[model samples]
Each structure stands twice: as structure tokens, then as C-alpha cells.
Target: MKITTPRWALEAAGAIGAEMAGTIAATGVRVVGDTALLSAVPEAVEKVPAAPRIAPEVAAQALYGALAAVASAPVRHSAPAKARTVHQTSSKELVRVLGHRCLKRLRRR
Candidate 1:
């Protein structure tokens, strides 16, 4: 985030052919570094408008903030379930819990 260049010129050193990715001027949007093009397309923006205009420092900062927010949002994880383990026990316990007849049937194999 803390690049050598001045904050005003927020061009990423590693960014290549990224300008073309912004085929649209996306407003009120955010995106990841991989598919940034998808969100860079501004809402209701002309896909292929006239000459490309330079992005103001303020606009770039805003975009950066929005993208950071999208990237840092809390990730949802599956909650742990209770009684998830199997009830492993001796054959006697299994027979007691399950039935003697059922155990006999299983033992014959």
C-alpha cells in the first residue's frame, strides 16, 4: 500500500494493461485485483465512450477505499455442529445400545 511514488499518482507498479481493463467508468463500485475490470465498469457508464479522461487523485482514493472495503469484509464460515462425532464403543456397548439380535446379525458376516 505504501508505494515509493507520491500518493497523488496511485499507479500500481505491477499493474499492466490494467488501464484497458477499465473499459467503463464504474461509480459506487468495488472489485478485487484479479477481476477488477468487472466492477470498474461504472454503473450506467458508456462501455466505449470518447477519449479517456484522467482520474483525479480524489477519485482514485475513493476507488481504493471502496476496493479495500470489499476485500476486507468479514468472511462467513460454517458454524460448528454439536454431537458431530460418532459414538464409538465396545461391541458390548454397541449391542446394548443397538439390540443383541442386530449385533448377532452383524457378527455372522
Candidate 2:
């Protein structure tokens, strides 16, 4: 017995394959089937010192302070809505009329 993959599955696989091939070519990486080979090992650079760790209590306090600051900030209401122009209104009406006409035609078919 033979099993066949669905057309959509094949299409999706093809798209993914194309994307992977493009990415590999763009990045100048060499690949043999599933395995990727590095052309050269990059030289190691001196690492920057990591930031000092904050105490749990200090971190908690800072988080609470930030939340409190945000909560206490005044809320600004948005400005009133602008009036619609004749062009905008007419376009909307036109779309509604066209949509109804299309629906009527479709139903009659």
C-alpha cells in the first residue's frame, strides 16, 4: 500500500523549504541535507561584566513603586470625535447600496 501527502501539506512544505533555502543563502551558511556546517569559527571577544544582581526585597520594592506611580498618574480622556465629511458618508452609503445589490443578485442565482 502507498500513502500520499495532501496537496496543502506539500505546498506548505515547499514554502517552508524555499524560506529556509533563502535564509541560508542570505546568511552565507552551508547546509548538507538536514545538517548545517559552519565555514569558520568566529574569534571570541572579551565579555562585558554582568550587572550586579538586585536583592529580592529591592526588586519587589521597585516593582511596587512603579505600579503605584502608574496608578497615581492622571488619566487623559480622548478628544471628541470629528464630524464625518460628505465624501466619507457618501462612500459608505455607496458601499452599502452595492453590497445589497450584490447580495440580491447572488440570492437570485
Best by lDDT: 2
Cα lDDT computed for each candidate against the true fold? 0.43, 0.54
- Give the Å error, residue 8, model 1: 39
- Candidate 1 residue 3 Cα shift, in angstroms, is 37
lDDT of 2 by residue, 1-109 (tens): 2355665666666666667667887887765665222222234345566675988899977855554454444433233226544454454444444555554564589
Backbone clashes counted, model 1? 2
TM-score of every model? 0.20, 0.27
Clashes of each: 2, 0
RMSD of each: 25.8, 20.5
Clashing pairs in 1: 25-42, 26-42
Please write out the lDDT profile of model 1 over residues 1-109, one tens digit for every residue: 2224443333342243355455333443554455454323223323454553656887877755554444444332233335232343344433343444443454587
Looking at candidate 2, the ten consecutive residues that score lowest on lDDT are: 35-44
The local lDDT score (0 to 100) that residue 87 gets in candidate 2 is 53
Best by TM-score: 2
